[model samples]
Target chain A: MSAPIIAIDAMGGDYGPHCIVPACISFLAEHPSLQLVLVGQAPLLEDLIARSSIPALDRQRLHIHHASEVVAMDDRPSQALRGKPDSSMRIALELVRDGKAQACVSAGNTGALMALSRYLLKTLPGIDRPAMVTAVPTQTGSCHLLDLGANVDCSAEHLYQFAIMGAVAAEALGKVRPRVALLNVGTEDIKGNQQVKLAANLLQAASGVNFIGYIEGDGLYRGLADVVVCDGFVGNILLKSSEGLAAMISARLEALFASSLPARAVGLVAMPLLRRLRTELTPAQHNGASFLGLQGIVVKSHGSAGEEGFRSALRRAMIEVRENLPQRLHGRLEHLL
Target chain B: MSAPIIAIDAMGGDYGPHCIVPACISFLAEHPSLQLVLVGQAPLLEDLIARSSIPALDRQRLHIHHASEVVAMDDRPSQALRGKPDSSMRIALELVRDGKAQACVSAGNTGALMALSRYLLKTLPGIDRPAMVTAVPTQTGSCHLLDLGANVDCSAEHLYQFAIMGAVAAEALGKVRPRVALLNVGTEDIKGNQQVKLAANLLQAASGVNFIGYIEGDGLYRGLADVVVCDGFVGNILLKSSEGLAAMISARLEALFASSLPARAVGLVAMPLLRRLRTELTPAQHNGASFLGLQGIVVKSHGSAGEEGFRSALRRAMIEVRENLPQRLHGRLEHLL
Candidate 1:
């Protein structure tokens, strides 16, 4: 098989090429049949590439495409699209759209990435807007949740599309018949708002999707269903809140261990297991969130991610590229429609 | 101030009188000026009460008011109201309404409790609906989050009322000029749906409220604001999801500590600190969730709570009763309107 080329928005995240270049080096070294085009300012990319310890042959597989501008983390999607036509994020997505790369990964402004991706790649037929889908860790395993801040005021039809798209992504990537659920306050049919209630009915009626009634926030982490669907507003809040709670608990645990001499000793002995536990639950393990229902694959990395996190995101993009996830989603959605 | 009398729904929760009676016994012993009325089926409660070793004097402080029926956890609000007219949950609220009790505590079906309480006591003047308000632990301290599972699809006015009610509750109970914020996906004015954005404008323009801008779910636990307002749909999902995530992490931590002999040895030494941590963060420590904007105070405990959890809920009701929270809210809300 020919080597698959992936485009990376090199000057996107908080540390720009500093984070992206090293991650690419590690990824390229691991995957022999992979090529990466780092899209950013040529001078900075060259500087980062020179400093990065990429193996000679792997280095030969790395390419640089200069994009004059970088989208700031806080830039509005409209502003980023209008003012920075040559942005690294836009250029990287453009490469995926033009099939120069199978997929694109960006750690830039989320709003801009979603907007530019939709504008460039367009939504798949019968899809209104692309939903942000991410794999979240649960008790049994990980489950995919969609619309994690893409379209805030989603209609019932929008949610129905999210379920179809989420189920499609789960089946393609997770390799399981996706059990879809609407995220609600209560599991009862009488619970939640009109939109969710309507969405639930649509999901239940839809063929080929395993619509498993309703799931609450707690149920989302319990691995109750394969795909939990919601509007971007609720999904975004749920994702962020889970993150905040995790960080708080971790910080509290650290403080507890550091508070006393005996605790310190316990911490010393338990350090290895604790480290393993942290790695298992940390956000880095699930860094890339896919813009599902798009015409081409686009993965968004957390902007503040370090090398490990960025690499995780790039790896996710690579898997989607290998799976031809966007095309798979198209087929599944077509059959469902 | 006179000794406050709290009416408890002894036949409401999963364990019914077994959990409620013991909690009331402990609560009465702790507070010399406290009185309790355990409302439930007389024979069953009498059997449990008779079996328990209660100090004679404290026993006199507790009273059992008989009710014929119970509200099952799964019963619909409307169904419970129609079919179980003489339910323990209803009788307990009626005691508060009849001026025989200062406050009511229920571990009943939340929907039933909210519906019956609204029907009996009615919302405060200028209030449209009563919101479920609770204090959630954060990095700095606990913050009051409102409409936790009450009105699912909240309009701009409904959210505005929640802000007023939450702020008033915080001031009356939390003893601070609450820093109120509209819960949204993003903190920016341009973010979130039209309802939240409109609520933001209303909150900002309102009088006697410390209207902080938008707060994400993560910020809810960061103690960034004293009162976070959202539609019950989002609020309930957030609350339940947080609970689920906390439980998952705690379970994982336990597994981590018990995985090997060395880990177990470390766990033995860290047991005391871990116990302290658990006590501080457990749901039992913060069991009561208030029904705000109502004419009378009502605290809803977790339906499956044990003795300690039930006691926490009763204690919260006592504190709210002592503060004359409902009356204070009525006065404060008058000016806001």
Candidate 2:
């Protein structure tokens, strides 16, 4: 009858505890069956929480664990692994590893997080690498896209493993019998390189995956499949390109509205519609990138996430913990592999 | 001096001459000196042109060069090359090969076009493989993105060639000393695969290229650099994913606006702004994908492009011919390599 505890790296984001503490307080208010362990510099987090309007009952559920070091945004992954042993990001993952928390969430350097999590908790059985999976907003719903910069030069075997993990993760996230597709330039059988062709054959022959041949980049956002799989290089590029295009469009819209009085008036009238569009497309709404295939559940918040975005990541971690995502993925992968 | 004659693959796209003939007529009306050789089944093109509003003066500049066959969208590239010798796509390129036309434009199968063009016009000296370059709409203007799906498995040398050609193409397209950046997962020098890293080194050392370090996908539409370079696989995925995401967002906006009467009223008031946004972001506005590093100008339009989109491709080919893009690329690449 004990509530699940989630560990938060309070000093990991750009604004550190200022963003994380408020987010944790907000998250705690909503989830009654959850407790939080804030991992960071105790004094700084304490100061932040004191300034915030957290209720006494919610405050009682919040615990702070001190860590001396912090991972810099520009720190090399290898350097962070070797140097920052007492870092907030490392401490949060350690809580998950030691069973002190059901899940761990951090708004830290993505490369550092991946390296340290793999080094600490290690990959699940039959998994050589832990691919990063995130929910990309699509037409029908969101599609689970994997290898968003884990293994850049992935082999056919690596892609096959990703397909297995992605399928399990998608199914665990409530997609029944997730339709999986390999990402390529074209949807044809002979579109990409030798590796992709080999991966396609392996995926087609593999058990437990609803392999739907090849899907192109444009098809990915159309919600053509539940799971869109690719090597980290291509996946990362696709994800980032989408982000860049979205940002550019947003900037253009702002300029257009500011250009003339008529445009500004129309924008004001369409403010509610515009807000919905912004909320629906913004990356912050889908903030967490799950480090799938790890032995324990660890979610990565964007390093520059604000309060609401960090809360979105924390909420994602709670959902993963409730679903027992890592366990589900491990079980499915074992049978499938 | 005679007007530059351009070859057109009239029976190549989804609607074949129905799309191509109308586009040709519109383009001729704009540029009086421009001549077009419509290569396809002469009867189909003639019938379509006869039905179109082609004035007697403009009709004199239009000529239909007959071809016996059409290249199917799904035809295997190699099979199409050998089997469809008298194909419309082939005859159009042959006009350029024989120096009868200054450039060739097609809204046909991409792989077939690339294969036959490589076999016919050949690559510029020192360029191993031709890259498909296209102008992606950005905030400032448009960025020339290359290797958009010509070579799937690109080595460091291949990428280096692409970078050089892309830079040259950008400069020829009016960008002053085009700032070229290698597209990768992150902006860091050590972010991508071995090939990308090696290409980065090669680009940095090469002369005549304003080699900026690395740019992530999100930077592409920001106009951070005039030319963004990547292997064809990554480039193609980025291009298509952007297209897919843009389309999805447009559809979502329409649905949101049409959801309620109030929202529809706001949409009606904001129709002009929405129209402006659509004109700015739609793929149809940036329809042509230029085949760079070839010995002559060859532009590929979308297979299902409408009359306006096909006209965009023809205009692009004309621009390349006027800029002498291929010769400029050849000269620059020879020195850079």
Candidate 3:
């Protein structure tokens, strides 16, 4: 296979290029056949690259694509679309659309990224709208949760589409015959809102997918299903709430560790294992969310993602590129929807 | 002042009277001025109570109000309401309705309990529906979250009422002019669905509530607001998902502790503090959820809650009864709505 080139929105996220540049150098060193087109201001990108200890050979593979504007974190999706044509986020996505890169990765405004990607690449066949899907850590492994905030108001058909796209994305990420379940308040058939109930009905009769019954939010962490689907409104809240709870627990543990001398000794011995466990389940590790059902690949890093997390988003984009996730989703929709 | 009498659904939860009977005995012993009516099948409840070591004085405070039927976990709300008129849950609510008891507490089917509560007690004036409200531990203290699963499809008006009711409940629980906020995907005024945005407008103009702007799920755990309001669908999933994540984290920590001798030694020393933290944050400690906006106090215990959890539910009822929460909500609605 030919070397793959991935587009990066270096000016995105809270930290911007200072976080993205080092991640690019490290990631480029690891993947010998990979190239990155870092999209941002030329002078700033060049200055950061100059200060980095990147090898001469790896530097040859790293390129800078200048974009004039940067999307603010709070930019409205509509405003970001119509107003900022030369934005780093928009240009990175444009790179993928123009076939300059196989995939686009950004730790930018999610609404802006989604809006720009859909406007640039459009949706695949049999897909109503692209959905945001990300893996959340569970006991057995991690499960993919979709519509993480892309579509706040979704219909039954939209949910059914999310399930189908989620299953394809899960399989592409290496789960075989993934069990797909609708996220609901209760597991019973009679539970959930009209959208979920109707979506469940559609999923039950669909082909080319393993449709499990409704799984409650508790079941999500129990690893009861490989792919859990919900409307973006609910899914967004679920993901954020988990992050909040994790932060609270970590803070409490830290406070407890600092309370006394013997407690400090125990905390010192115990924290490594706890921290490792946290990286496995919490937002710090599972960093990227894919905008599934788009005509091309787009991975969204958490807006506050660090260097390692931005690289994780890059890794996700590379995997989806190699897997040709959009094509796989397109094929599955032909049979399932 | 007269002693407060509470009606209990003795055969409600998974363990039935085994869990309730002990909790009842312990609670009765603690409150010398309190009385309890344990409603269930006469023989089973009687047998369980007899097996327990109860003081003669405390036993006099406990009475058996036998009801032939039990509301099973899987029973539909409508079916439980219509077919199980003689159920322990139903009779317990009836006791509160007839003013024979100051409040009612149950660990029965939530749907059935909500249905029964609404039917028996009715909603407070100006309140269209009753909502389930629970206190979740936050970094600062604990915040009240409402509409756990009663009204899945809530309108802007319903959410406005929830805010009024939530504020009243928070104040009744002791917070002075408790800050109320609508739970949404983003905190921006332009963000979230029609209901939340519209509800925000209503809350912004409304009196008697210290209405804060929109709060995201992460803000929930940060103790940013005293009361967070959402539709039942979202609230149910949020609470259950939090439980699931806590369980997952605890399990991972336990596995790490058991992996080696050195780890086990550290675990033993660390576990006491960890367990205390878990109890503070997890459902294991916060056991009861109040059915807010009802004309009378009806605290719903977790069906799987243990002896201590049931007792926590009982204590919640005691506090609500002392405060006369329903009357406070009624008065608040008159001023605000």
Candidate 4:
């Protein structure tokens, strides 16, 4: 098989080139057949790359697309996309658009990335909107939540499409006939607003997908359903709130363990258990955010991603490319729309 | 001070009279000044009351308001209220309306309870809509979250009112000048939908409430702000999702601890730390769900609540009654409306 080319937004995340360079070198060392296009200002990218242990052929396999502007983390999505035409994100999307790379990966402004991907690549046939889907680690396993922040206001029909797309994605990850659910105020069919009720009814009767009734917000990290669907607005809230709560709980546990001699002794014996729980909940272990329904693959890394985080994202992108996720999604959803 | 009379929905909740009777008996034993009115079928109420050990005065304090019809958990709120006039929940609400009880407590259908509260007691002065406020256990401490279920579809103006009411409730809990925040997709003023942006702008400028800027969903369990405001719909999703995730995570940890010999050995040492974490995250520790913006005090316990849960609800009801939360909210929000 030919090498899969991935365009990386090197100047994006919190640590930027410092994190991206090492992660890319590490990834390239592990995957000899992989080619990469690192999009950023050449000077800084070169400075970071020069300090890495990536081999000469691996360097030859790497390409640079110089872009001067970097979108700040807080920049508005629409404004950022429109203002920075030659941004790493925009240029990276262009690589996939022009068939230079199989996919684009970024830890940049999430909204801008979504907007640019949609603007440059457009939605796949039969898909009205493209959603950002991410895996949240749960006790049983990780569950996929869709439209995390892509389209805030969605209709029942839009959610139905998300369910189909999400199910397809989950299946690719080995969940055969993944249990699909609409995120609502309660578990009952009649519990939510008109949109949710309408969506629930349609989902209950929908063909092919496993419609597992309504799962509430608290179910997001519980693995209650393999694919939890909601409008971008609610999905985003659930995603962030779960992340915040996990962090808060973890911090509190650390404080309790470090508080006193007895607690410290308890912590020492429980170290293995705590380590397992911590590993189970680590965001890096489940870091990829896929832009579903796009014509080409686009994976979003955390904005604050460091070396390991970026590598995790790259690994995820490679899997999506190998699975031909976008092509499969297009095939499944085309007829539905 | 006169002993406060509280109406208990004895035949409500998942466990119904079993939990309610024990809770009532426990409350009576603890508080000498408390009086109870058990509302349910006469036969069931009488049987449960007869089984209990009570002094003549306490027994006299326990009056039964026979309600033959019972609203099923899945019954539509408006339909159930209109159709089943003599349901336990309806009778409980009527007691408050007739001034027969100072407050009403239930672990029944939350929607039915909210509807009954709105129908019978009506909204207080200057309040357009009622909200269900509950104390959520967080890493820092417990914080008050309003609009947990009521008024799911809300306007910016309604959320502003909710903010005012939430602040008053927080102050009643002794957090002076409580920091109020609008829950949004992002903390930035420019992020989220039009509703969030408009609400954020209004909240930032609002003088009566101590309006902080936006807070993300993850902030809820971390105690980032005292009062986190959102439309009831989103708030309900946040509240329930956090709860579901916490419960699911805890259960998963237990399973992991029992997985193998090494895991079990680790579990023995980690039991205390895990116990402390579990205590911090326990739903019982955060039991009260207050029907805010109502003229009378009404607390909704969880449907499967036991004696301890009901007692917590009773205590919260007493505190709200003592603080005169309704009157304080009325005074604070009258000008804004």
Native contacts conserved, per model: 0.87, 0.94, 0.87, 0.77
Candidate 3: residue A125 Cα off by (Å): 1.5
Per residue, candidate 1 scores C-alpha lDDT tens digits across B107-148 of: 889999999999999999999999988888788888888888
Score every model by TM-score.
Answer: 0.97, 0.97, 0.98, 0.95
Mark the 10 consecutive residues where model 3 chain B has the least summed lDDT: B278-287
lDDT, candidate 4, A70-119, per-residue tens: 88777777777789887888888899999999999899888888888999
Question: Candidate 4 local accuracy as lDDT?
Answer: 0.81
Which digits, one per residue and each the tens of the lDDT, describe model 1 over residues A6-81?
A: 9999988888888789889998988999999999999988998898777899989999999999999889989998
DockQ of each: 0.77, 0.80, 0.86, 0.64
Which parts of model 3 are misplaced by more than 4 Å?
A: none
Better of 1 and 3 by lDDT: 3
How well is each residue in B1-337 modelled by candidate 3, as lDDT tens digits? 5899999999888888988899999999899999999999999888888888999989999999989999999999999989988999999999999999989999989999999999999998898999999999998998999889888899999999998888888888899889899999998877899988999999899876799899988999999999999999999999989988988888888888889998898889778777777666656335689899898999998888888889999999999999988988887788887
Best by DockQ: 3
Clashing pairs in 3: none
Candidate 2 lDDT by residue in tens digits, A1-337 = 3699999988886878887888899989998778999999999888888988889999999999999999998999988899889999999999999999988899888899999999989999999999998888898998989988888989999999999889888887889999999998888777889888999999888876899989998888889999999999998888878877877776776676677887677567565665566655656335678899898999988877788888889888888888898889888877878
Residue-wise C-alpha lDDT for candidate 4, range B256-323, written one tens digit per residue: 77888866775676666666666556453347688889988899988866677778888888888788
Candidate 1 stretches greater than 4 Å from native = A282-285, B275-285
TM-score result, candidate 1: 0.97
Instruction: Give the worst 10-residue stretch by lDDT in candidate 1 chain B.
Output: B277-286
Q: Candidate 1 DockQ score?
A: 0.77
Q: What DockQ class does candidate 3 belong to?
A: high
**What fraction of the native alpha-carbon contacts across the interface, defined at 8 angstroms, is recovered by model 4?**
0.77
